[model samples]
Target: MTASWPPAPLSVDEPVGAPTLLPARAYVRAEVLAWERRHLFAGTWSCVGRVDELPAQHGVTVGDVPVLLTRDGDRTAAFANTCRHRGHELLPDGGSADGRVVVCPYHAWVYTLDGALRAAPRFRDVPGFSAADHGLVPLPVEVWHGWVFVNATGDAAPFTVHLGELAGLVAPYAPEKLKLAARHDYRVRANWKVIVENYQECYHCPRIHPELCAVSPPNSGHNYDLPGAWVGGAMDLREGAETMSLDGRSRGAFLPGVDRRRVLYLALFPDLLLSLHPDYVMTHRLRPLAPDTTRVECSWYVAEGVLDASYAERFWDRTNRQDWAACESVQRGLASPHFRPGPFAPNEDAVQRWVTLIRRAYLGTPPWEGQ
Candidate 1:
């Protein structure tokens, strides 16, 4: 199903004073998650990993569909990870390097890095068998600013088009020139949407994130509603604050041309979250494991050869744990039969936009109409 871009405006009669959140079932129902897996995840551009992570070969799941990334010479290619013979998974999840050929563990079907069927054990004996007709199915993959994003349906619009003006907003950081500095993964007991909603708004910042609020006031920012699938804005840092580290000081050199007084936060719907600071960029890629569980991979990037990242890492680790704890609490409450849709605060405009876009993608209706 094609998503309706720039979701239609909400109904005027829809109550904003106590604007209802997406129904509780949306967070804990198995059928609802399956619908999202088929429509939302399958049809959008979801980031998988960094370009450097797949220098050889890597296997990953975009939503629920397993895919493989291989570097063929100077180019990277993506294909369905299932072998054609019997639908067995070709490579293990998270990737591995066993040379140029990908050999299926079940039947030993060998495929070249470019996804060509190289050989199959005793397959020629079958009548009218042709390896040429059974090469791995290709998926659409685009590498933008050193990150790799893949679309399972292979029919979505170009990645840049989906990104809209976000590309220009973050151009000053020169993301392509930044190198990976540290990576951390967390498995949170929360729905993927819960995590996203928590990140999009800072309503809970002052109460939950003391250090973050000290450096960047929770009430000192405005939200921007960008076209396409992104929503974000810049938040001003405290008077003497250089960055969002534990001590309000920058841990490394400023990213080429970034402004030191403000930091940018963006929520790229369905999967990616970005935190752009003067000295570094932090990315969070969320993968849904179940209706109530998600796997979040957080990575930090900075100018090449800068090795000391403890300051930034420690601060974010503490902040992320706080966010995750809040999300988990919300998830538990959502499962209760008494839990109903609640009002959104004025500070949660970005969260409203996120909910609108996701509702459009999943139910083909705006949140107000559904309510």
Candidate 2:
């Protein structure tokens, strides 16, 4: 390692005024992945899952900790999933304790919907034992649009502040009111960042995703400024295409208030990849497992009355597999001892911005506190 960002920069590998890629080691090193898990994911507003996916279940795993998300009527709450006594899991692993109140399955300790300790078995006469101190360990949670996001440490910036102008940008679509049509899961054989970089750019679409290029011209898009913490933009649909299908045909009604012919793609920093089409919305949440492996959960959501998402799901699943194959190939190539990052293309502006952001975050922040 050196004084320079990413230890070494291969400026000679590409042209001047071009963005440099992150070092290969950053994607392959274990300690680097650990640092990202702690700083970039843990305290951040990690999207556990959507409200519609797990209808009655409230438990989720963020990083290594299990956090619970519960709703009572119009109210919602989040907290550590362990009971105050005996540290037993208040909710079974990845299962729900949903009802009027959360009951610890172990000792029958009970907690209110708001995570307040209500009953503690039969231990009554313990002097100075305060229920106030034993209330569930609360975690900050926000149900943005339709997605549920949680901040484990409860010290990160407020969810709205972190989102910035993102709310107003997508309000016209009323994504909160959208309904899930289909869901799919995959174990991607590539790093999380590789998948993200692939999603943000279409430079390889012409070669790798002919099905995608058939619907929308890969070059017919403009990148959006930082509306919030997210980075994304839109691509114009071809003359006759109504949505992003294999042949650019609509399988559902156009979304409410959507009159234009374009598709919106956004990487809601850290984890969520959001794509908004004329008639539906698709999202991919990246879960980094090891340095070279990631798990991607994809769901297609359509507005009310749009029916099922068979068209959209089949289309994107094929496209997603194509991108994943390429990413896995890139990862294999990057593993070589002499690999170096190449320059960013003019069309890869979103990829460039993402790389710069990651580089700054990695280099600007001290590796550890008080170092």
In terms of TM-score, which candidate is strongest? 1
lDDT of 2 by residue, 115-145 (tens): 8888887767788877777889988888888
TM-score of each: 0.91, 0.89
Q: Give per-residue CA lDDT, model 1, range 220-315, as digits (tens).
A: 878886566777788999999999998999868887767888889997756889899999999999889899999999999988878887789999
Best by lDDT: 1
Question: Which pairs clash inside model 2?
Answer: none
Instruction: Please list the C-alpha lDDT of all candidates, in the order they appear.
Output: 0.81, 0.78
Q: Pairing residues by index, what is the TM-score of model 1?
A: 0.91
